[model samples]
Target: MAEDNPKSSVMKAGVDDAKWYWLAEGWAPGGHIREVDFDAQMRGIDPLFEGIKIVDCDTHFTEPADLWTSHAPAGMKDKMPHVRRIDGADQWFVGDKHFGSIGGNVIAKDRNKLLGRLAFQNYDQIDPGSYLVAPRLAQMDAMGVWAQICFQNGGVTQVGSLLGLGDEPLAVAITEIYNDACKERMDASGGRINGMGTLPYWDKDLMNQEMRRIADMGLKGITLPDRPERVDSSSAYVGPDGKVSPFWAEVFEICNDQGIPLNYHLNASLDANSAIWDNLGFDQKLPIHALLHHVGCAATLSNFMVSGILDTYPKLKIGLIESGMGWVPFWLEAMEHQLDEFRTRENRGLKLRPKEYFKQHFWVSYWFEDYAPKHMLEEIGVDRVMFETDYPHPTSLYPGVQDKLVETLGQHDYATRKRVLQDNAAELYNLEI
Candidate 1:
């Protein structure tokens, strides 16, 4: 009777038509929808980052396996950095010691796949952009990054490890080779990438000569290992006597005079005790080790703060690279508190409190951080904070860097965002863009 009725027939037809409509819309009976094209969706422009310039203060690149070998002086060819097949993998050899492997240097592409592994053994496995300047610029453009401050990968440590094993000529030659390669890349980048020169911290005369050479090369800054001793124990720049060693003072003065900031990257200190952590097993050791990575940087800063270095050279600018600014607030506060409780004219080399010196002389970089910028802006000061990507490293903000920055600094006004993202770094490094 219902089927025969005209009204009932019309209602049944409408319901049946709705089923076909939903099917065409890609919805199923279980409320499932067809797969989405996320990549295509991401192609849509993000209004938040529109027209915003981003200057990445920290990024790393792998040196070509032949960097030292190709550039070493004719007489120093035998002492150059080279790759040797050890067991089944490629190991980087510098003067008789196995410094590192080429594998883990460029992990940006297969990071998820090689999550727990330390280094990648060969160039075939790495992203070309990791070592090649042209491709790296293209990658930066795709990510909306305006510029980068580039640092060496394991090559710095490798040069350091060669210490006593090689003669001064070989050591200086190796340093020159690496610096030339960096300069060549920077020259090729059309101002988008600025290479920080590495100092031959072992010999005072060589270090001075290289510093002058780096300044002549028009490099923006110089990279100081968090622990110079890690590279060569006898040549440790900072020790029981403090960072005021004639070598350090001269280096600082040269940087200040040349207008190049002294840049300190994290994890330069490799403690002998770190080997003991292996007994804790990978799972337990990994997290704890990561937690302690910044300790050396803090110690380095403490030494500088108390040594009157900042007070001695007012124009000297120091950039703390790859070390997040989150810890800075508490670190400075603790330093200030200690200064207040224990201030003696003899021991207190600093005319100002640690925090005051920090505010005046230091620029700190932050990446993969959200809460620090928002909450500690006043303590850290917006002017002293700079943004970094730590690109191509394990902790880099690569594909979705814009989104992460927006999420972190969006709540602030455009001026603050602009300063943190670009203006501060530009001013610090004297970058045009």
Candidate 2:
């Protein structure tokens, strides 16, 4: 953490968190916890989900500041991803180059602040569960969730920035440490928290090696760059005229053969960083960014639907993480309609329709949408859908996950609810729960 982001006393026994910095007026996590009652909330939701171990297929683990530097050798320690307080914001840096602020926080002491909490001025103000494995599991337990597939929250492995530094070793170290940290967090969580792997995607050889390593280490899946050619226009994956060549074939094959799902979290890639307008205020841009992020996932789905990747590697599973499922039916309809109208040479070669491809290979996760869960689960394919709570991020389904569960999934039959909330993800990630 940065100098100003003081270390938390959360692990300190009986420390009285209500008196803690920036926690609520009477905040105590295990006790009263101000006005919060997770047990009561889960009790309300229990009949529908009594025996089910709900799988939150998409949540984020905010990386601790030492995630990289602690593992780096002494000489390279200062150069690995480390935080420094810059302009009153805790920003990550690699050898004085600014990565970005660790800006995913919008929770405090297990409380959701969508209406009251505006911004996290420093790391200390954020929830401990955001970065800690034990607390994350506790958070899941409190919310009536059994397991979570976690992604890197803070955009630390965007890779383009690491590649731009022209230091391949540093880039590799950053990626390796992130992947290593993913495995570490998974192990520490007793498999309740499965962190997805990342890759130094500009290099195909390195990417292939890391995928194998991830599979061997039992990391559930990997998040890919939607366009790896954009990482380095001169890399081997970059063909003539800066077009992407047959670079992603091995990735698809490995994922298909190994049964490793390719998760697209729709963050720091797929045009997500550019989704928000420059003029909007921080809070104003927050929601607009997330809404547009779902649109990016829609584009990703459309691309894969027509790209022939699914047809070629028919068994590969795709996860649209943190992407709500309400828009998918309409998007697929629009795509099928366009395919019918355009009948181009390329469109003629696409063996399956967009919706067919989606049903065959892709899986999506939804959070905080009532109509979709209640009325449209069948439309979204309950077998291919899962639940998530986004967890501590802005716009996350925090402080009311059980409420949301009861409101959205409560009406469904037991089997349907089990599939959406647990079985799909358990089969996908092979989580024991």
Candidate 3:
């Protein structure tokens, strides 16, 4: 059984993909696209960014249905994730269990904004740029973006469902297919987009081999589960131990040795704030959950700050993707206070305080934020902060990426602006452009 969350809990009726699928009825408060001069924006770079190539650190790449099947080894094709039109929505499935939807794509093929609870419902409705390489490159130029770090939409990398299917060989194959496709996309786009890779997180042997493979293959980074206990199981990863596993630290050491960044895109865990959803209806709860999910990284990252993992692997670079930067200062302050109040730092034998570790080991991306950009960029460390437009996803800084870049970031001095908007990402991802 799949995790029945708001995104994938659509009433299940139909099963099987289509020669072409019909669109599902959209959610309430959806499809309100702002009127913008689409043609002009697409013509060329925005003058405000006349000389800089902005890097959007966080964007979700909608995986094509054939992403795995077409690329699969002849024997493994049927076992990979395939899209089935269920109740009019395109849902991913493996064997019999459900995976997840083609997550929150708010951009329409016709270029209308379909945000908030509103969704495209199927591949027929999304922009080609959201998935295809050529259009993605063109849009990057139009939006004055140099490169983007993309994650898979719905596949093995997605938490829970894919791994819960409980087959290790199938999971490894699924992860490799996505990573291989990312390399192809990177080469095809001339390095304009770098899709982060995922490992078979449930197994240490597979995780070790895959991490090394991606590094040798020149993959920029790999998305890891911040909560390892939930992922590693007796059938694959390990039994009994969860978060406290020494194996987790060993994986970090491999990443550090390979100079591979460890990326933990916001996962569904440790969110003290999501409890507010118990009272609201799905549509009402959706937006708040999206916001809370981003802030939830505060818990994930802060936990690592004291985990002594980074203290062991000091050179390991970690990224908290799609988690906005607004809550960082307050969260760091809160963390430091607890460390001081309880004297945990002295006991932990910490080399530095929580803030120091955050700056040293972690990097974060932001979209649709003002206070952090307007006031807190300095506090967050310009070198550690990067720009993001969740691009195409609801709440992504879509349509107005160029306008917003100029609006929020234009006032800063050129060096600072370039660092936040472009250089930090280039440094983090080893992006050539």
Question: Among all windows of ten consecutive residues in candidate 2, which has the lowest summed lDDT?
Answer: 10-19
Backbone clashes for every candidate come to 5, 0, 1
Overall local distance difference test of candidate 1: 0.68
RMSD of each: 19.8, 9.5, 5.5
For model 1, the run of ten residues with the poorest summed lDDT:
21-30
How much is 411 displaced in model 3, in angstroms?
Answer: 1.2
Whole-model lDDT, candidate 3?
0.73
lDDT of 3 by residue, 1-433 (tens): 2232333212221222211121233422345666556776554556766677788888888888888899988798888888898766777778777666766677778776774455677788778888888888887877778888898665435545545656767777888888999999988888888998887665667767887788878988888765554433332112233233555555677678766787877755554343674766655766666667676677778777776666778888888898888888889999999999988888777778989999888898877887788788899898989888878676777676877777788788888888888888888887776
Candidates 1 and 2 compared by TM-score, better number:
2
Better of 1 and 3 by TM-score: 3
Q: How accurate locally is residue 180 in candidate 2, as Cα lDDT from 0 to 100?
A: 88
Residue 421, model 1: lDDT of 82
- In model 2, what lDDT does residue 197 have? 91
Ranking by lDDT: 3, 2, 1
Off by over 4 Å in 3: 1-36, 40-43, 233-244, 271-274, 277-279
Model 1 pairs whose backbones collide: 103-119, 103-120, 103-121, 104-119, 104-120
